[model samples]
Each structure stands twice: as C-alpha cells, then as structure tokens.
Target: MNTCLRPVAEQDAAALFTLVDTHRAALASWLPWVAATHTQQDSLAFLQHSVAARQQGSQYDWLILVDGQLAGVCGLHSVSAANRRACVGYWLAPPYVGRGVMQAALQQLCGQAFGPLGLQRLVIDPALANVRSIAVAQRAGFGFEGILRQHLWLHGQPHDAASYSLLATEWAVRQPVQA
Candidate 1:
C-alpha cells in the first residue's frame, strides 16, 4: 500500500476525468460537483481552477495515488485567510474503499493545512448518512461538533450534515513527542 498525494496539475485532466467518469454513480450522491463533470474539458477546467486557487491562496487540491495509480482527489476549499480555516473535501474510487487509502490521504492533507498552510481550524462536513466519510474524520481525530440541518443541497434536495472539526492545537497535541 504505497499511497501518496501530489498537487493537481493541468496535465492530469484526462486521468482525473476517467477516474471521475468511471465512479460518477457512486460519487454523485456525496459530491455535488461530480454531476457537472461530463467531459474531460470539464475536468481540465476544474484542474485549472485548482491551480488558480492555489496561486490566489484560496484553495488547494491534490490527486490521491495508490502505488502510482490515480485513485481519488482530496482538497481544502472555502479557505478564509482572515479566519485561518478551510473546509476539507474528498472522494475515492470504489476499488480503493475500506483500505485506509482515504484515511492516510486525509491525515497528510490536514497536516499541510495546519502546518505550512498556517490554518488554525480544519472543517469537514459530510452528509449525515455518509458513515464512511464521517468515520474518516473521526478516525483522523476530528471532534464531532454538531449537526447542521439541511446544511448541504445535493441532487436538488437539502440533506442534513454532520460537522466535524480539528483545531491546530488539537492536532498538535495528537502529534508524537519529539526526542
């Protein structure tokens, strides 16, 4: 299980599109943007936007790789410089599910968010019924903040979401003590 993350690049548009297109049905329920990605061009636009966002210090996205295969994507979005916080989002292909791929990817992303990104709070809001996503957050040491009724609108309908948060201070406490 050699898993890693790399910043999303323009050249990855085709591969990203293929991954999303193949898992559209499974991802559409949890990720709203999956429905809009009907073509490789749409993915290119998304990758381009991610690059721009990183430059503007608004967001950062990365492609998840497991043994050199594009397995998914994860990112920090809705970044607020003044607030020093951001929301985390991710989706994985079905083949990589239940193998701890997302868990490792998420920890790495959170470390970036709380470290050099200089963020204080990291948020993850998964639909209430998305047990797998919620578990990822919990397993990564995020605390259950509360539920936001109808916090997310997916497939033209409002859905309740569970809010989880990991503060930089909390994350720091979880880190191993240095020698």
Candidate 2:
C-alpha cells in the first residue's frame, strides 16, 4: 500500500506513453476509452497537455507511483469552482491492477481533492463492463448515483456507464483509512 498521488511532471512523457502502449491492447476490456486514445505522438502530446493544464490551475493530473514506479495516472478533470465539484478518472498499468493499488490511489487522491481542492464532490464514470473500476469506486467510498445509459461513445460504440460520486461532507464522517 505504499502509494502516492504526485504531480504529472513534464518529464513523465516517455514513461507514461510506455505504460499506455503496454496496456493498449488489454486495457480495452476495462478502459474503453483507451481504444480511442491517441497513438504514440498524440499520447505524448496529451501528457504534455496534462502537465500544462496543471500549470494553468484548470485541472490537476497526477502520476500514481507505487514505491516509486509509474503504476498509473489519476486526475481531477472538469473542476468547477461554481459547482464545487469535479470529475475523476484514472488508469493503472496492467501488472498493477487488482492488487488494491488503484483503491489506495483513489483514496489518497480523493482526500486531497475534497480537502485541499475545495471540491464538494468528486464523480467517477466507469463503463458498465469494467467491473474492476466500479469496485475501485465502491471501495473508495463513491456512491452509485445512476447509470448514464448509452451516454458515451467508446471505440465507436455507444456504452452505458455507472456514475459514482463522493462528497466532502461524507468523507469527513468516515474513517480516514480506506479499507
């Protein structure tokens, strides 16, 4: 459980892309969007954009490191000051999945986001077929709001997704350590 939510630095471009490419084929079963994700050049540019977005205070993206290795990536997207909410997304290297690594990462990031980011709520949308991701949300204390039926397109197919959310007030009452 030695995990952390650290900033996505500019230098992470190559390594992050390596993770994406390595997981590209297999991740589609869980990460539907990975199918539509950019190729090598585009992936590098996207990671660069992630770092740039952090600089502008418009978004916060982090690399999830497990004992110092690039285990995954996590982020708060679409931060809304007026709404006091944000959308969350994450992905872990294939080898790192199902070992409670993502669960730990979610717990750490959710705490920082709800506490320091001044966000009232954090929302996660996982494809219905992605059971592992749904489990992570559940473990991290996100309540199932509803299914956004056919609400998104992944790999050129309409997909149903489960929406989960956790609130700052809710986290304040729960145990700090996510079991």
By TM-score, the best candidate is 1
Candidate 1, 1-179: lDDT as tens digits? 98899999999999999999998899887999998899999999999999999999999999999999999999999999899999999889999999999988988898899989999999999999999999999998999999999999998999999999999999998888989
TM-score of each: 0.97, 0.90
C-alpha lDDT (0 to 100) for residue 124 of candidate 1 = 95
Q: List the residue pairs that clash in candidate 1.
A: none
lDDT of 2 at 174: 86
Least accurate 10 contiguous residues by lDDT in model 2: 31-40
What are the lDDT scores of the predictions, listed in order? 0.94, 0.83
Model 1 segments beyond 4 Å from truth? none
lDDT of 2 at 60: 90
